[model samples]
Target chain A: MEDIIVRYISRIIVPFVQLYGLYVILHGHLSPGGGFSGGAIFAASMILYALSFNLSAGTKKLSHDVSSVLESGGALIFAGMGLLAVLLGTNFLGNRAAGFPLGIPGNLFSGGAIMVITFGVGIKVASTMITLFYSLIEGEGHSHD
Target chain B: MSAAAHLPALTVVVPLFFAYLMPLLARWRKSWCAATTLAVLAFTFFSSLYLANRVMSSGPFVYHMGGWAPPWGIEFYVDYLAVFTALTISGIGLPVIVYGIKDLPHELKEGVLGWYYTLYLLLMASMLGMALTNDLFNLFVFVEICAIASCAIISIKESRECVEAAFKYLVLSAVGSGCLLLAIALIYMVTGHLNFTFLAATLPGVMAVYPKNILAALALLMVGLGVKAALFPLHVWLPDAHSSAPSPSSAVLSGLVIKIYAVAMIKLLYKVFPATFAGMAPVMAMLLWMSTLAIIIGSMFAIVQEDIKKMLAYSSIAQIGYVFLGVGLASHNALLGGILHIFNHAMMKAMLFLAAGAFIYATGVRKLSQLKGIGVTMPVPAGAFAIGAMAMVGIPVTNGFWSKWYLALGALDAGKPLFAAVVLVSSLLNGIYYLPIIVNAFFSKPEGAVAKPGRLPAVMTGTLVVLGAGCIIFGIFPSLVLGLVSRATRLLLGL
Candidate 1:
């Protein structure tokens, strides 16, 4: 099935999918698609890239080391956000009580903890996807047999 | 920041963050993995102790995660009950790592060591998280993490049986996790809260409003956790996985992992289920009777096993039965004894596994029959095993004895002298299986008995000695542990 349609779709759809993934991530704080959903989209974008190309070629673009670091960094950032409250003379993860400006509840960038937790959930999701991809890529040709 | 809200988070995050940082750092230096694990464990131990102290002096400590503040947010209760569980996880866990350093590399294949530590730390973190979590959903999450990681660890050796056994463990445990998740969702739907304390407030109303939901959720939770905990009928996964896994993983799995799940069960019965649970008194009796069966059946099963590890694995079910029986009684002291056994068993049984591994390390022996002449050759490990054997049989001057004594006392307290007698009888049965190993080791002489050894490596030998010594120390120093346990039980029972 490696025909003209495959070439054309890969040419046009891949960039759009990738761009849409970026849009989801950036617009997470404002809309229904926050960190976890957006991060999943980001991972799916890479996976689509891999499926179009091969595993090694795709991983070359999305490195394992960088992904693991992102995973760890994401978790750390999430935890660090919580710990920041402790440093700020409030309790740990005291999002609203520590005053992150809970703007109009229905508006974008509202709900202080919602944003922080969203970001954290995003990082965790992104990292997990990356790690999974790495494992899949690294063990591409290996067989239990 | 009433101190209740953060203790659980600290217990979890200290180990979790460390576990996360560990392999990342181990990417640079391998020794640093072991060193970092110990340091993180030390930090967790101290934090748990501090939580225990607060629980003892102040009362149960409650912490809300993300400061969304429970019902809406995850909560951890660092009561004496939780602190005690956390302490057991760390206390037993630290020594396991110490033993694993030389011993595990010897037992497992290459390309798996880093993953081993990853799974180990994850195991420790999950147990810690499970023990401390007050939110049912959070507890379920930690339990799944523990189950997955533990199952992975079980098959780390790449043995054919290990693979099949781990697969069995995986499928059953995944089912159990699904049941637990379903239970959590059911509870949340009924109680409108995932936080345990909130559930405590709301459960009575929910139980009244939706009695069917109450039973369904509690039953599902029990089935899920019982499988995870390896209680009676649900315990089919334990023996194969425990025996087939590498020694260190076996030690952790048999020693403390199951009891942490039992503690979760305790939370369900006493805290969340309560009046509804008592209303289901028939179920409790069924649990008690089955635990009695577990004690009888597990000890008998242990006697027949030729593989040294298999014998110890069966012994674990029996030892766990004592905890289940005590908790099953659900009386104050009975529950205390069950809770107390968690720490006691963790120390004593893991000591047995480590000592067993030492033999496996030096002589490459796996079966009990093969070890007839082993005592003559490997005196220290054999001696350590003998001490562990005696401890397992609940001999006085070992920690096992005290927990069994408490359990017996608890049975008597519950006006069930027959069950107390059973507890006593199980000890004898424990002796029946374990004593032969000692006698055969120290006395019997098989062919080609070569007594050439200083000791297993210090990491290995030292861990066994310390744990064997701990079995004695904790036994002798009963008041220290009992005080913490009684306070912990008081917290659990809300006295």
Candidate 2:
């Protein structure tokens, strides 16, 4: 949209939206929201930015190529963490018994590999959302911008 | 535990790990996509072999996920049946993907090629997971994965027909998934356990109290899995989805994907449900009647189809009936015949589809009439098609005969000579449809496009050769697979 008010508001509000998403992802083990929800929330900020501006501006911010790489990388990281447990002589995706230090139960870093997995999932979900949106829009006969 | 203790998990995980990497590799190292896929599938194949060897030597074993025990944690049970299924999937999947290596670029867009590999690997991992998983929820998860991946592969061709067929498959498959989830919920309500072993142990106790719920669950399970397995009347989505798909996809879907659900159904029916349950008779009878219909109708439909893949797709519905008929018969030799048919049919169908793909790739023709004298120009694919046709007809010395032999024997053993007659009639039907294709290809003179086709890829032809050989070799030595299938039969029958 060409309107000043909408762009101004989105510019100011987007960063905080991203911050909340990160909070949810980091605290996934301690609280309710985890990778999927947090990542969707994170992606919403970018989607808002894209909506307020033009497709070109959105593409400039996160190109399709970069988003795809991020998508694959996120899943790879998740699988990699599980493989790490297997390498540690524990089962695939083994948690506390795999010898990672479990901080206080309610602490931010206490869930061993859970937080990391959530982080990977969050990144994956976010990029996947962006890619999905972009592809759908691209598939249309004309770009709105 | 040693690293050797991890083969079961590794068989699935390795493919999943590579699937994630496929798109990335496709972008930066475009050439690596197919090679990486091959390598990943090769790993799955060999590991499946290793697990089969281990299961044969030591009997069945279970592996706990994340070091947690079952009833709480997910577990993979490597029984003779599971290993047999795993072996069949990986064995056939490896060659199909090998064929896809050359065939895919011709069918799909340049950008989606990497994603195709991703979908193929995901499908592979999910089928392996379906085979080994002992948890109800885990099985559901794998089933969904397999469903989505299979659909994606079909629609990746991006043709109008492909997209339409995929949508139909997606809708029907989703309904099937919902039914399965509800059935699992019902089972959990009564038994209070998601693990197969725990469910089996507690189900009998609850059966006397909640007979209706148990029966409802059984009915839903049968319909749910039945739809996915494309059992008879529920197979509306299969022909379009399988035929419109890329050839490699057709090979996998008709060859292995549908069979996995049948394996899942067999597991639930034989392992979890108490054999002496009061409702067993009606269920088996229902299965017997449904399969009889599927066999006859599927073959009759095949006879009328002008499109080659469509005909093959219809035939699959019939072939799957043989597996179910064996299960429905509920005798030792019957179940043996059913289980053996799985391996035999997988080889035959995969080879046939690949051979069909080879023809389309070269001649760009799909009509049955136009394939005349195809044997003269494209000897390898045409010859492969001939062998596949013979196998389909249950001609002696082809693998198809042995399964039919057992099914017929099993029917007689079960005191149901009628189904044996049905088996014979279906074989005749099979010959009626399939034999004409061979005779026309080999005996008739070539015309326009069929006269001189494009060059066939070595890899594609080579895959056909291997699959065709597999049909004959396994036929000549039924004992090779019979040992496992019989053991699986004994285990299922609790003999």
Instruction: Choose the strongest candidate by TM-score.
Output: 2
User: What is the Å distance of residue A87 in model 1 from its true position?
Assistant: 3.1
- Candidate 1 chain A minimal-lDDT segment of 10 residues: A1-10
Clashing residue pairs found in predicted model 2: none
Interface RMSD over true interface Cα atoms for each candidate: 2.8, 1.0
The alpha-carbon lDDT assigned to residue A72 of candidate 2 equals: 93
Worst 10 residues of 1 chain B by lDDT: B446-455
TM-score for candidate 1, residues paired by index? 0.93
Checking candidate 1 for backbone clashes, the offending pairs are B4-B61, B4-B62, B4-B63, B5-B62, B5-B63
Question: lDDT per model, in order?
Answer: 0.80, 0.93
lDDT by residue for model 1 over B15-54, one digit each (tens)?
6666666557757677788788888888788888887877
Question: What TM-score against the true fold does each predicted structure earn?
Answer: 0.93, 0.98
The CA lDDT at B3 in model 2 is 74
Tens digits of lDDT, candidate 2, A15-123: 9999999999888889999999999999999889988997789889999889989999999989888888888888888888788788999989888898899999999
